[model samples]
Each structure stands twice: as structure tokens, then as C-alpha cells.
Target: MGQPGDQFADLRTDYERHLRSERRLSDHTVRAYSGDVESLLAHLESSGISDLSEAGLPELRSWLARQQTAGSARASVQRRAAAVRVFWSWAYETGRVPRDVASGLKSPKKQRRLPATVDQGAAAAMLDGALARAEESGGPVGCRDVAILETLYATGIRVSELCGLDLTDLDADRQVLRVFGKGSKERSVPIGGPAYRAVRRWLDEGRGLLAGPRSGTAIFLGERGGRIDPRVVRRIVHRALGLTEGAPDLGPHGLRHAMATHLLEGGADLRSVQEMLGHSSLATTQIYTHVTTDRLKRAFEQAHPRA
Candidate 1:
């Protein structure tokens, strides 16, 4: 091995490559992991420890403690700690470190914040608002907006997955969408008739008007007619939801949460939902259980006479 600093730099590169080529992590995940490792390396440098291999649990705990002292949110600190643990675990397995120094490091259990969701009535009104707006414009963009809102509620796909959709991804005959989710995992999610109608209208009547010379086979397009950006999807959702009186000012993810909660409440099984949402772990899908539980508690309190 060269100097500790050089070893750290070289190992970091290898780790990133491992994340990308071997682990097949998405760009966002890769960046997040790289950022956490960089922060740890910086911390190690400050303590005159150039080699990451020489660092151990005390240093890891100190770094976490410093993050807490600096007022990082518990959620953020937790993720950072997870990132570090994953990194050290990889290092040990690959022989960069003698052992997994971060194996015992534990992040505080994250507070399970219930996702915000509009009740059925509000959701219906929101969809109605989207349809009304579409009729008023009578144009492709309006059709696209209606489709965007409807598909988000109908399928519960991530904004990235929605924006990433191409012409071939929609199966109108079957009323299903081919969704490539995080880590590029693919799943087919069914689309309700209303959403399917809106998408069909957009494809048939609206997309042509917006298509430019640079336009490709993208299902959703920007003003310049290229593939839509996720930020634009967020803005569209916010604007569409804003049109509905008494509705929460939520973006696409809010719609996703609503879809998941509604599905669970309507008797959709956990395993099916896990497949539809493309969740890698059942635990991630279980958050919607809390949403349903809260709803049940409210319903019982409203109707039951035990009080």
C-alpha cells in the first residue's frame, strides 16, 4: 500500500466503481453513498488519520456525534450512518480494511412519520379538477396534465419512473404500464380506465401538437418537446392539486402515498402492493400499514360508542 491518503483515494474509487458496475445502484444512490464516504474521509483527515483502514468504531461514532452536534436531522444522520456502515462492510469484504469497523454502528430508529394522503372524496375531487382543467384547455398539454395526475394516482409509480416512461412503456390494450423503478427493476402496474383514457387522449390528440423536431418517443414531454423532467412532474402535480379546494399541497409522492394507502384500505394484499410499488423490502411497503391503521382508528372513534 502507498501512503494512507493515497490508499484512501484509491479505495474510494474502487468502492464507487463497485457501487456502479457491481452493485448496479442508481446514479442518485451512488452519489449519496459517495457523499457519505467523502464526509467520513474528510473527518478522518482532520484527525490526522490518512488511511481509512486505520479508522475504527470510535472514529465512526465521533463522526456521527459531530453530525448530531451540528444539528443534522436524525433521519439525515441515520442515512449517513447507514452509508458509512455499508462502505466499511464493503471495504472489509474486499480486503481494503482488516475488518468491518462500522459493523456495530447503529443509527437511531427513524421516527415513522405517516405519509399524508387525501381522503377518497378529496382525491375524487382532485381528479375531477384535473379533468375540468383538461376540458377547459381542450389541448394536448391539458390532456397530458390530466394523464399525469391520473396515472400518478392510478399506478403509484415514482416521479422518476413516470418521467422516464417512453411510448412503448404504455400498454393501452391491457391497461397496464411497464415501470422501471429504482435500481432499474421492472414491474407492470395496472392502470384504471380513467387514467388509461386520459393517457390515450394525450397520445392520440395532444402529443402531436407538442412534438418538435427534437422530440423522441417519450411518453411525457417538456415545453420544448423532449422527455419531461421529474421537477416538472412535481410542479405539475402541485399545480393540479392546488386547483382542488381543501386539498393538500402535495406533489407526486403524495399521490403515490395516497394510492398505496387507498389500495391497502380497499383490500389489496401487502405482497401485491410490494410488487406494484417495486419495493425491494417488505418493510418499506409496510409504512402504508400505519396509514391504514390510523384510518381504522379514526373510523372506529367516529362510529363506535365505546367512549
Candidate 2:
């Protein structure tokens, strides 16, 4: 080609195309993977390895070791490693490389930190604050805010799933939401009366005010009347929590954790919770069980008099 770097650039473009067209990854994911692979290619060049076919696990490990030396978080290193492994997998499968050195690569073990969540009382207070603000403002925006908080706390869907919702996604009669989660996997999440009423009020009294000509059937719209952005949803959660006194600082995902933990404590089975939250594996849902168990242990330790 024109230069040694040109081949790397071309391969990077092709890899991005493969991630988007064949892997069915989201644009955000595709971009992240592309950036990681680009970094790997740069490392390869620095190592005087002009050809990717000549690259081996040693080169890959050195690239990751440099990230560690640079103080990259373990999670970041893990994700980068995964990106490289997939990249080489693709390279070998496509005949760009005779062998996949990345096949032998391993990511750092992920640290399983307990997800932070508000207590039930804090969640109630947060929702109450949202509703009070709606009442005081007497505006469509306030109504929308109330609906957003209520829906997130009640259904425990991801911010993206909440933003992706259309009016048709709501089963108003049955009080359930048709949520498309990660990988476009659809799951039906039941809504309690508080969440249902909040959504109904927004649909009736709020969304019309924000509807622009470009606004489609999306259930939630931004101030510009376009489908709501996930960032906006996060801001809504953050701002609501900020107003709620004594509540922990958390985003939309915190609400998901709170919902799961509260359900587990309320006697909901793991399988039911798993299905509601759209977790593909029961093990992923089991973390909440640990949360509940720890709480129970604390209570026992506090109340029991015997050693």
C-alpha cells in the first residue's frame, strides 16, 4: 500500500465494519472495540512488527502490561484484552492471520463489587420528591420527570431500554412494559400501580407539550421532542437523587439494583426476578441474593443476644 501504517488503518476500518455488520454490536460498542484495536495496532508498530501476521501473544501481553504500568483500572484492562482477543479471532477466521495469538490471551479477573443501591425508604422518598416537584411546577416537563423516576424505580429497566420505549411498548391494560434490553432481547416487565398511573398521566398530560414534528411514537422525548437520550435519563435520575435528602448519589443503574434487592427481600423468587430484569443467566441474578443475605446477617448479629 501507500505506507506501512496504511495497512493497519485499512484493517482497522474493516474490523469496525465486521463488528457492526456481523457482530451486531451497538455503535458505542463498535467504536470502543475499534479504539482498543487501534491502540493494539499502534503498539504493534512500536514493537517493529510491521505485519499483523507476525504479531504473537508476546506482543499482545506487552501491550496490556503497558496499560497496567500506566495505571489503567483492572476493568479497563479486562475490556481491552477482550477487545484484542475478539480482534485476533476475527483476523484469523478471515485469513488475515495464519494463527490467532490472541486466542491464548486472558483478561484480568473482574472484581465483583457490590452494586450500590438505596434502601426502600430512600427509594420511596426519591419518588415522592419527583411527584412533589411535578405537582409544584404544574407543567408537562414536571409530569415527564415524575414518570421517568417512577418507571425506572418500578420496572428496573436499563436507561437505554427506557429511552428506546415507544408508546406501543406499553401494555396499559395489563400493566406491563415490552422492554428490549441488551442484544435487542425483548422481555415483558410488569408495572405496579404507581408506575402505571405515572406513565398514564405523562401520556395524557405531558408528552404532547414536547412533541415536535420529528418526534416519533417514542414514549419518552427530550425537550427537543426527539427520542430521549440515555444521558438525559441518567441526568434525570441523578438530579432526582440530588433533591432527595439522605439518598445515595446514583444513576439509573442504581435504581435497577434497588429494585432487584427489594424484590429479593420481599420474597420474590430468583427466577422471577431474573426474568423480570431480563438477565439471561441465573448466576447474574444471584448477586442480589448476596446483598439480601448480607443484610439478613447484619440484622441477626444486631438482635441475637447469644454469642
Candidate 3:
């Protein structure tokens, strides 16, 4: 068995590879885990913990306490703790440590922050403004922009998922879109009538105008006719929101949040919303229920006879 000090890098490398190959984590997630483990190793070095076998729960807790004292957010602390646990588990399995010291280590409980979701009227106005700007430009790019916003809002898909979509992913006749989500999980999400119309318009008019000989099977294309980048989608969403009055300046996720919030507000079931949003866990979907409750409370205060 290799000594703990000598195996830190090897363990980290293997852990990262495991995350990529076995867990199928996205690049962003792999980077986050890598950063967390690196931060822990740096802390261990400063703390003089030279051997993996020498580490224990007290050392792990102490590190977490220091993080708390340094004002780390609960979410970050939780993630760091999770990373440490994964690292120790890998180390133990690979004989770098006699046992997993990080076993049963509790992470700081995170208070979930409710995401900001725009109201239906504001959402409509924002989409309208985006479409108007696209029309005013009177170009293929503008039409494509309008289509992108419509698809995002309509399907409640992540920007990355939307950008990864191909032309065959859309079943226009069935009003469904095949979305590849986190961990490359695929789900069929529905698109509404308005979004369908917008997408059809883009395909017929805008795409043909922008597409060149090199254009591939991507449903959304850039001016040069290759696949559209996620960064461009973010920029388009940011600019579109800026043109709206009093609308919250959120990225594409805001539109997704808006869609879930509005759906729940309009009597959609929680499980159905969860599936539509492609959330693997119902817990993640429950946050929107709280948003719905807050809205209900406000409505009751304004209109109930008891008040």
C-alpha cells in the first residue's frame, strides 16, 4: 500500500477518472469535485496530516469548522464535505488508508434558496420583447434568437441541453423534444403551440438563410451554420431580459424556473413538473411548490373574505 502523502495525487486522479467514467458526471461537476479535493489536500498539507491512515473524523470536522469560521456558505461546505468523503472512500478501497476516516462525517445542512421565477405576465412580455427585437432586425439571426427563447421557455430545458439538441431530437408532429440532461440522461419534454410555431418559423425561414454548405444536423445553428454555443444562448437571454422593464436579470435558468413556477401555479402536479423539468429527484422539484404556496398566500390575503 502506498503512503497517504504519496497517494494523494494518485487518489485524486483516480477519483476524477471514476467520476468521469463510472459516475458519468458532467465536466462542470468533475471540475467542482476536483477543486474541492484540491482544497482539502491543501488544508491537509498545512495541518501536517502526512498520512491517510493518520487522518480521522476529528481532522475532517476541524477542517469543516475552519471553513465555517471563514464564512463559507452552507452549500459550499456541504459540497466540500461530500468531496472529502468520496476521496477517503476511494483511498480506503485502493489500500491508501486502512479505513475510510471520512465515513459518517456529517456535512453542514444546506438551506435551499428558492429560485427566482418571473410571473406569467412578465415572462410573456420578455418573450414578446425578444421576438420584437428579432423581427426589428429582420434577419435570420434575429429569428433564430426568438426561436431559442421560445424553445427554452416552452420546454423548460437547460441551456446546455438545448444547445446539445439536434434536428432529429424534435418531434414537431408530436410536440415533443428529446432533451439530454445532466449525466447524459435523455428525456422527452413537451413544447407548447407558441414555441412550436416559433421553432417552425426559424426552421423554415431563419435556418435556411443562415445555414451554409457546412451546416450539420443541429436544430439551432450560429451565423456560420455550425452548432450554437451555450455562451451565445446566455448572452441572448441576458440581452433579452435587459430590454424588459422590471424583469429579473437571470440567465436561461430563470426561464426554466419561470416555466416550472407557472406550471405549478396553473395546477400542474409536482411529479409531472419534475418529469417535465428532467429533475432526477422530487426534492429539487419541491422548491417550486413553495413558490406556489407563497403566491397562494398573497392571493388569499388580497381576496379572501376572512381577511
The best candidate by lDDT is 2
Question: Model 2: per-residue lDDT, tens digit, 72-149?
Answer: 999999999999999999999999999989989987898877889999999999999889888999988889989999
Write down the TM-score for model 1: 0.94
Query: In model 1, which range of ten residues has the least summed lDDT?
Result: 1-10
**In model 1, which regions exceed 4 Å deviation?**
1-7
Error of 1 at 98 (Å): 1.7
| Candidate 3 residue runs with Cα over 4 Å from true position | 1-7, 212-215
lDDT of 2 at 29: 92
lDDT of 3 by residue, 264-300 (tens): 8889999999999999999999999998898999999
Strongest candidate by TM-score = 2
RMSD, model 3, all Cα superposed? 3.0
lDDT by residue (tens digit), candidate 1, 1-307:
1223554778778989999998899889999988888888888878888777788899999989888898988999999999998999898888877989799998888987888887778789988988888898787888898889999999999999998898999987899999998878899999999999989988899898888876788998887888888998999989877888888999899999999999999999999999988999999999999999988999999999993
lDDT of each: 0.88, 0.91, 0.87
lDDT of 1: 0.88
Error of 2 at 129 (Å): 1.4
User: Per-candidate TM vs. native?
Assistant: 0.94, 0.96, 0.92
Q: Is candidate 1 or candidate 3 better by lDDT?
A: 1
